[model samples]
Each structure stands twice: as C-alpha cells, then as structure tokens.
Target: MSLLVEMRGIEKRFPGVHALRSVRFDLKPGEVHALMGENGAGKSTLMKILSGNYQRDGGEIFFEGKPVAPDSPRAATDLGIGIIHQELSLMNDLTAAQNVFIGREPRKSFGRLDEPALNRQTADIFSSMNLKLDPKAQVDTLTIAKQQMVEIAKALSYKSRVLIMDEPTAALNDAEIAELFVIIRKLRSEGVGIIYISHKMDEIKRIADRVTVMRDGEYVDTVDAESTPLSRIISMMVGREVSEKPLDVPDTRGNEVALEVRNLKRGREIRDVSFTVRRGEILGFAGLMGAGRTEVARAVFGADPRDDGEILVHGKPVSIHSPSDAVRSGIGYLSEDRKRFGLATGMNVRANIALASLDRFTSKAGVLDERGMRETANNYIDQLGIRTPSDTQEVRLLSGGNQQKVVVAKWLLRDCDILFFDEPTRGIDVGAKSEIYKLLEELAAQGRAIIVISSELPEVMRLSHRIAVMCEGRLTGILPGGAETTQEQIMELATQRESAMAPVGEVA
Candidate 1:
C-alpha cells in the first residue's frame, strides 16, 4: 500500500484560538486510518481543511504523491475525495435518488432531469452495497440508519478514491453497523483509502488498521490499532489517563416519588409503558436504537401527543397537552438532536441560556430584564464551565460539549424539578463528559428527578440510580443500580419483545 494523502505541519487559526497546530496526518491506500480525539481536539478541523471547507494557515497537502490544493468542495470531489459529515445533510423533501445526485444530476437531450436514468443509477449503487432502499422514496421517510446508508451511498457514487466518514455509527444499530463494515471492507479490497473519525473505542479496535491520536489541536501519536490498548489510546487523546469507573450518584431508595407514568402509549413506538422516578435520582432509560427510549421521553415531556397515559407530579395528576404544559408543571426536556430541537444555533449563549425561563426575566409591564438575564447567563457560564469567550458568543461557535452545557443551563434556570436528558453526552469529549456527569450528580443531590435516555449501555449502567429497560415501546423491567447489573443484563431486557401491558405471568 502507498500513501494516498498526507498533511505535514498543518496549522489553522481563528479570531481568538488556534484550532489546529502542527498537525500531521497520513492515509494509505486500502487501509482504514482512525482519527481518535475528544471533542474540540481538532479532529473535525483537520478534516475540514482536507475537504476544502476551511483553509489552513500553513500546511502541505499531498495527494497521490503530488502536492495539491482544493479550494472548494467541488474541487475536492473532483479529486476523488468525498466526506460524509457527522450530521445528515440530505434535504428531507427530496427523493433518495435526488439527494444522492443532487448537484451532479444526469441531464437529458433537452437539459431536463433524466428521472428514470437517475433512479436506475441510484438503484444500481444500492444494489452494489446490498442496501435495500427505494430510489424514489422520500428521504424524510427513511430511518436514521437508512439515512446514514444514503450518505454512504452518495459518497461512493462519486467513485471516491479516498473517503472520510465522521461518526458514521452515531445513529446506527448493531445490525446496521455490521452492514456498513461489510461495505467498508468491500471498498478497502478495491484499494480505497478510508479515514474514520469517531469517539467509539470498540469500533476503532474492530475496524481500523492504524490509529492516530490528536489532543489540544496537535497530533499526539499514531500506532497499530491491534497492538494499542484502549486505555493507552484514550490517554493519548485526552493527554491524561482516564478512569473507567461509572459516575457516582447518591442512592435514592428511600426517596419519595417525583414523577410517575402509567399506561403510556404513543404511535407504534411506545406501548403501555410505566415507570416511576424518585426525588434526587437519576433514572436511566436503556435500549437499542429504535427501542422507544427517546419516544417515551418525548411523550412525557409533551413534545409528542400520547394516546393514553397518566402522568403524576408528586403523586398529583397533571394534564400535559404540549411542551408548555410540561414546562409549567416543572418538567424540562433536552432533545437528542441538539441542533434540531434543543438550541437556536444562531443565537448567542446568553440568549439561549434564558430561553426556557424568559418569563422570569420579564417585569409586570412585560418589559424584558436584560441585565438580570445577562447576570443569570454569566453565572451559568461560570458554574457549568462553558468554554465560550463570552456570554455574547453565538451558540454555534462553541464546541459540542459547551453547547450541551448551554442546554443544561437553560433547564436549570427554569427551576425544572423533573428533567429529561436525551443523549446528554452524545458528541462530548472525555473531559466534558466527566464534568456533565458531575453536574448531573449534583443536580440529583439537590433533590431533582432526572431521567436519562441513552443508547450507550455503559453510560446507562454508570450514572443511573435505577435502570429501566425499554424494547419496542414496552418497559421490560427495572434493575437496581450498581455493580450487580451488567451490560448484557440490560441488553436482554432491551431486546425483550413481550408486551409490558400483559399480566406479569402471561408475558414472555
């Protein structure tokens, strides 16, 4: 195998920060190179420079042993380099074929869209990858796993010699990940170079041939994937050794019930699920990708209409018709997709921090208390350790972990008693994750009822005071927190297909 792409002494700078500093990276043909780093460690920055989204201040880029510069994404694509971002970028209203061939569509003699030809080409691509998807199907109608497949297919359609995948398995299930690996292996056999950026350690061990670690915007080390221990790789990525212990939270066994749900039902996804969370407790909801953990959170928070259910606050029934109702009842929900449903990206941090409790910053005459809001925002910025230059910084300018802290501060300012954290640490770094975990523990200690919905089994096992397993919208069972419960036990309950509504003895 030969070097397909190389970057030496790469440097990138912004207004007040050096985003990347003397970063060195290389990719070889037919080999999967893993880029491991914590959030904001310059993993995305380096890739963005390579993809022509950002221009490096100083660097040398070599492709196929020839020095080259790609001024735009089009130029990069023309050079047989394709990148699939962590976020899905497909237009929801467009058909699969349309999204796949968006800018490079086939044209007929009259310069009109060659609809049949486009669909046929897309079908061929899907067939080659053994992916079952209809070219004419609406992109919005597909599941997240299917949408990811479409992204991969789009990259492959460019006949890319070098492909970059960022967090490809972030939203995929085990089965979907297996399928993606098959495709990746096929590409490798065809001599395609692959650059994989992800925080998942197990995946790096399973699929990568070489591992490169980045820390604090600089290249740390690179080693053979098979020979490197996960701990050593983690140490290099964070610049320090990290303990693998689960987060610690106080026991909530004797606490009073804070929130309760009975016979909850939502469209096909959530069945007659029921659970109780006590004051000063972090109740974790664990399941597979489509296991209805998020759906249950949505229904409880009034983001979605429930078919039938009784929600109780402090043992008193409450009617929750919308998000406002839930908020008024002292409940707050943080969505899994932070960009879509959680924060206003264009807004400044101070404005977003006060978003949930704007009424508190209003006077009797309906005048906004700008000073008070600013003070509150400043307090949260200090307390949450949000890495922002100032409260006036745009939310999008902050890193993934900082943005998540902003969302948490939003709910904290609202004085919400019951909080639903959906994938709170999804794209966060190891350091930030520890901070968030500590924050959650402190919140629980303050007598708040928290429910965490996460797809990562280890996370659920670590921070939960009690674990509730959901499978296909049904609550399988609950287990006490601590060392007694294993990930496999939680998975068993997560995969349980029996209806929770059935009599205890009658269910599977």
Candidate 2:
C-alpha cells in the first residue's frame, strides 16, 4: 500500500500553549487509521493542519508522493481531501440536497437554479451509501443520524480520496451505527483512505485497520487494531494504567424521594416518563441517543415546556413553568451541551460561578458584591481543583473538565438538592471523566439526589444505584444497581421502542 497522505514533524503553537509538537502522521491507500488521544492531546490540532484549518508552524506534508501545502480548506478539498467536523455544520432551514451541495452547486446552461439536478445527484449519493433519506427533506427535520449521513454525502460529493470523520457516532444509536459501518465498509472497499477519530474503544476495534496513539501533542506508537487489546490501546492513549472500576452504589433503601414525576409528556419524544430519585442516591438514566433520556431531564428541569405532567419535590407537587421555577424549587440541570446551554463562555470564572445564585452576591441596591463573588469563586476553585490562573480568567479558556466543574459549582452554590447531569462526561478526557464520577459520588454521599443521563453503557453501569432505561419517548424498565446488571441487559431495554405505548410506572 502506498502512502496517500504524510505529515512530518508537525508543530502548532498558540499564545500560551504548544498545541502540537514534532508530530508525524500518515495514511495509506485503502486503510482506516484510528487516531487515539486524550482530550487536549492535539489529535484535533493535527487534523486541523491536514484539513487546512490551521497552518503548521513547522511540517512537511506530502500528497501522492509529492510535497504539497494546502493554505485553506478549499485548497484541501480541491486536492481530494474532505473532513467532517466534530460539530455538525448544516443550515437548519436548508434541505439536505442544498446542504450537500452548498458551495459547489450544479448550474443549468443559463446558470439558473437546477433544483432537480441537485436532488437527483444527492439521491444517487445516498443510494450509493445505502442510506434512506429524501434529499428534499429539511436538515432540521432529520434526526441527528440522518444529519450525519448528509455530512457524509457532502464529503463524498467532493470526490474525496481521503475522508476524515471526527467522533461520527458520538450521538448515534446501535442501529444507526450499524448503518454507518456499512457505508464505511463500502468506502473502504473503494480504496478511499479514512481517518477515524473516536473515543469509543469498541468502535476503533471493529472498524480501524491501524491505531495511532498520541499524548500531549506527540506521537506515541502505532499498533495493529486486530491484535492489540483494548487495555493496551487505552494505556497507550493515556500513558498510564486504566482501571475498569464498577461504581459503588450506597445504601438508600428507606431514603425519602427527592424528586417525583408522574405522567410527563412532551411532543413525541417523551411520553409519560415517570421516575423518582431517593435522597443521596445516584439514579442513572441509560439509553441510546434520541431515547428520550435528555427529554425527560429537560422536562423535569423546566428547560422545555411539557404538554402534561406532574412534578413533586419532597412530596409537595410544584408547577414549574420555566427554568427559574425549577431552580427556585431546588432543582438544577446541567445540559449535555455544556458550551452552548450550560456556560456563558464570554464571562469570567467568578461571573459564571455566581450566575445561578446572583442574589447571594447582590446588595439590596441591585449592585453586585464583587468581593463576595470573588471569595465564593475562589473557594470553589480551590475545592473543585479548577485549573485556572485566576478567578477572573474567562471560563472558555479552561479545559472541558474544568468548565464542567464550574457548572457543578454553580448548582452547588444555588443550594440545589436535586441535580440532573445530562451526558456529564461527553467530550471530557478519560482522567477528567473519573474526576467527574468521583465528584458525583461525593455529591450523592452528601445527600444530594442526582440523576445521571448517559448514553455510554459502561458509565451507566458504573455510577448508578439504580438504572432506568428509555427507548424512543418512554421509560422501559429500571434495574437494581450492582455488578449483576450488565450493559447487554440495558441495551436490550434501550432498543425496546415498540413497547413504549404503555404508560409510565408499568413494567414492560
């Protein structure tokens, strides 16, 4: 196999960080190379260089055995390279066909709009990838899975010989993942080299031909995916031994219920989803993406309007029409999309920490007590081990893990007894994930009711005193916490969407 792409001695630098250093990466024809790294490990930085999103400070890139430098994303695309970003980039109102051919559209003889030609071309690409989606369907109308398919279609339309997918299946379900794998295999057979970046070990094992591990912006080693064990791969990525510790669920058999939901319904996503969390207990919500887990959390936290439902906190029924009402009722929700929904990126650490409980740091004259806010922020910074130069540093400047801690501090300061963590560790590194898990355990130990919504089966199995699985828009079943409950059992319940017609609190 000949090398299709080569990056030698790649180096990238920011104001205070040497993002990448002396990194070497290569891709061969007809191979799926997996990139493994911890968060902030420079995998993305290296990819950005390849896709022409960032210029390397020092590096030599060779394409097809010839030295070449791409100055921009367009230049890379013109050279048969296409990259699908970690974040979905699509116009919500535009149709799938339009998004697929946004910059490069087919024109008629007179340069008039050629709607039929565009749809037909997109339909052909969809057929080639074994995908079922109407090209005329609006992007917002499609599920996350279908939107991902559109991105893939758009990449293929560029006549790309080398394709890059960054965490493509992070939000996809098992069925959708299988469909994606089929398309990947088809592309593999066509001799298109693929660069797959993901954190899921099972995915890399199943799809990748070779695995390249990086740590702190430097290449560690490359190993054969088939022969290498998952433990070994993880060890290489983190440069340390990793443990698979099962979560410790504390006793709460007779504890009072902190939160109760009855007959909750919101659109078609959540239907009569009812559950209760005991004080000092960690209740895990387990399901695939789009399984109504987050929907239930949003409804409970009053982030979304509910068509019909009843919420009871501490045995007292409360009407929560908005997030302010939920917060006043001692409930807080940490959204899965931390950057978008949880944090005010433009604000400093102290301001973000004080956001939820501004009254505590406000004077009677409506003036902010900067001294009190700074003191509280500093306390949280020390207690939570938030990595920052000072309390006034911008929240966006911190890592994902530290930013998450800020959110946790916010809810803690607000005196929220019942907390909802939706995909709490998504986009965080492995080490940071353990820290967050420990923090959740500590919060539960302190008698705070915690509801954890996670798509990762291992996380659900490792953290919950009891597990609730949802499919489509209904709670399927709840399992007692222990080593006895396996990932397979939870997945079985997660895929049971047909049985969702039954009302909540009913055993399937």
Candidate 3:
C-alpha cells in the first residue's frame, strides 16, 4: 500500500487552550485507520484541518507524495478529500437527491433544474453502494441510519480518494451497522483510504486495520487494531489503567417507590410498559435501537402523549399532559440528543442551568435576579465538578461531559426527584463516563429515583440495581443487576415478547 495522506507536526490553538500539539498522522491506500481518543484529544481538530474546516496553526499536509494546503472544504473535496462529521449535516426539509447534490446538481438545456436527472444520479450512487433508498424521499423522513448512508453516498459522489468518517455507527442498529461495514469494505477494496473515528472498542477491533491513539492533544502511538489489546489502547488514551469493576449494589429495595407506570401504551413503539423505581435506586432500561427505551422515557416525561397508561408519583396517580406538567410533578428528563433537546448551546452555563427554574429567580416586580441565579449555578458547578472556565462560558464551548453535567444541574435546580437520563454518556469519553457514573450514584444516595436508558449492555448492568429489557416496544423481562448478571441473559430477555403483561412488583 502506498502512502495516500500524511500530516506532521500539527498544532492548533484557541484562546486559552492548545487543542493539538505537534501531532502526527498518516494513511495508506485502501487502509482503514481508526482514530481513538478521549473527547478533547484533538482527533476532530486534526480532521477539521485535513477537511479544511479549520486552518492549522502549524502543520504540513501531503497528499499523493506532494504538499497540499486546502483553504476550504470545497478545496479539500476538489483534492479528493472528504469528511462525514459526527453530527449529520443534512437539511431536513430537502429531498435526499437535493441534499446529495446541493450545489452541484445537474442542469437542463436552459440551465433550469434537472429534477429527473438529479434523482436518477442519486439513485445510481445508492445502487453502487448497495443501499436501498428513494432519491425523492425527504431527508427528515428517513431514519438516522438511512440519513447516515446518504451522507456516505454524498461523499462517494465526490469520488473522494481519502474519506474520514467520525462516529458513523453512533445511531445505527446492528443490522444497519453490518450494512455499513459491507460498504466500507467495498470502498476499501477499491483502494479508497478511510479514516475511521470511534469510541467503541468492539467496532474498532472488527473494522480497523490500524489504530492511532491520542491523549491530551498529543499522538501516543499506532498499532495493528486486531493485534493490540483493547485495554492497552484504552490506557494509551487515558494515561492509566481503567478499572473494570462491577457496580456495588446498595440496599435501596426497602426504599419507598418514587414512581410507577401501569399499562403504558403509545402507538406501537411503547406497548403495555410497566415499571417502578424506588426513591434511592437506579433502574436501567436496555435494548437495541428502535426497541422503545427512548419512547418509554419520553412518554413518562410527558414529552409525548401516552395512549393507555397511568403514572403515579409516590403511589398517587398523576395526570401528565406536557413536559411542564412532568416538571411541576417533580420529574425531569435528559434527552439523548442533548444539543437538540436539552441545552441551549449558544447560552452561557449559568443561563442554561437556570433556564428551567427561572420562575424562582424572578422578583415579584418582574425583574431578573441575576445574582441569585449566578450563586445557584456556581454551587451546582462546584458540586457537579463541571469543568468550565467560568459560569459565563458558553455551553457549546465545553466538552461533551461538562455539557451533560450542565444539563443535570438544570434539572437539579428545578428540584426534580424522579429523574430520567436517556443515553447520558452517549458521546462522552471514558474518563467523563466514570465521573457521570459517580454523580449518578451520589444522586441515588441522596434518595432521588433515577432511570437510565442506555444502549450499551455493560453500562446498564453496571449502573442499575435492576435492569429492564425491552423488545419491539414491550417490556420483555426484568433481571437483577450485579456480578451474576450476564449479557447473554439480558439479550435473551430483550428479544422476548409478552403475551400478557404482568405486574413488575411481582416479577422475580
């Protein structure tokens, strides 16, 4: 394999932070190089420089044995370099074909729009990739996995020689992931070099040819992915051996029930869902994609309407018609896509934390009590150990973990006792995940009832006192969470369906 791309001595700085420091990276023809790092480890910074999203403060880039400097994304695309960002960047209202050829659509004789030709071209691209998709379908109507495939099809349309994919399977199901792997392998066979960025060790082991580890803005080392132990790669990224300890189960069973759902049903996504969480317990919801874990959480939080169900807070039935109703009933929900549903990224930390509880911060004369809000925000910042320069720092500037803590602080400020965390550690690094886990334990110890919905089986097994497995919009089974619990057992239950729902309290 010949060298296709090389980046040496890359450095980037932003205000008070040195994001990347003399990092080096390289890729060969037909190679799938996995970039592994903690959240702030400069992987994205390096890639942004490669894709011309940001200019490198200092570096030398070589493509095909020659020096190259791409001043913009367009220039990089012209140079056969393409990138699929972690956040999917597709216009929701546009058709798939329109998004695929936004600025470079085929034209008619009079320079009018060539609708049929455009759709045909888009369909051809999809066919080449073996992806079944309608070119005329609206991007918003497609599933996240389908939208991701479209992103890939768009990149391939550029005939890119070097492609960078960041967290490509973040929202994909097992089947969709398999399909993507097939496409990636096909591209690899065609000698298209791929730079794959991800946090999932199993995925890297299965797909990557080589793994490059980065820590704290510096390149650590690169090794054959299949040969290197995952623990070694993890240690390289974090600078320490991460403990693989099982969660210590506390005696929270004797605590009073904080919340209960009876016969919860919503469309076909949530059917006859029933569960209970004690005041000082963490109940884990585990399932595959589209298994209705998120739907259950949303319905319980009143973000979505429930068809036939009853919710009780402290054993008393409560009617929740809206999110406001849930909040007033002492319930809080942290959505999976925090950027879209949880935080106001443009706002400062103090403002976002105080957003849900602004009613208490307003004086009787209708004036904002800025000092009080600041004091409260500072208290939560210290308590939660949120790493921010100051409370006035924009939420968008913080790392993934700190942004999550800010969301937690918002609900805490609102005095929510029955809390739901949906994919709380979705995109955070391992170090940040440990911190979030500790914080959840602390909250549970403080007698707050917590429900955690996670796709990772290990996370659910480690965090909850009891695990609830769902399959096809129904509660399949509940298992005890401890060292005795096995992934296979949970998976089995997750794939089971109930003929008649039983009371959760009576389940073993």
State each model's C-alpha RMSD to the native: 2.4, 2.6, 1.8
Q: Give the TM-score of candidate 2.
A: 0.93
lDDT of 1 by residue, 111-195 (tens): 9999999999999999988888999999999988889889888988999899999999888878888888998888888899999
Which candidate leads in TM-score? 3
Worst 10 residues of 3 by lDDT: 499-508
> How many clashes show up per model?
0, 0, 0
Over 4 Å off, model 2: 364-367, 495-508
lDDT for model 2 = 0.89
- Model 3 lDDT, full chain set: 0.92
On a 0 to 100 scale, what is the lDDT of residue 265 in model 2?
Answer: 96
Q: Enumerate residue pairs that collide in model 1.
A: none
Give the per-residue lDDT of model 2 (tens digit) for 136-167: 99999998889999999999999999999999
Candidate achieving the largest lDDT: 3
**Residue 392, candidate 2: C-alpha displacement in angstroms:** 4.3
**290 Cα displacement, candidate 3 (Å):** 2.0
True lDDT of residue 242, candidate 3: 86
For model 2 the local lDDT of residue 360 reads 86
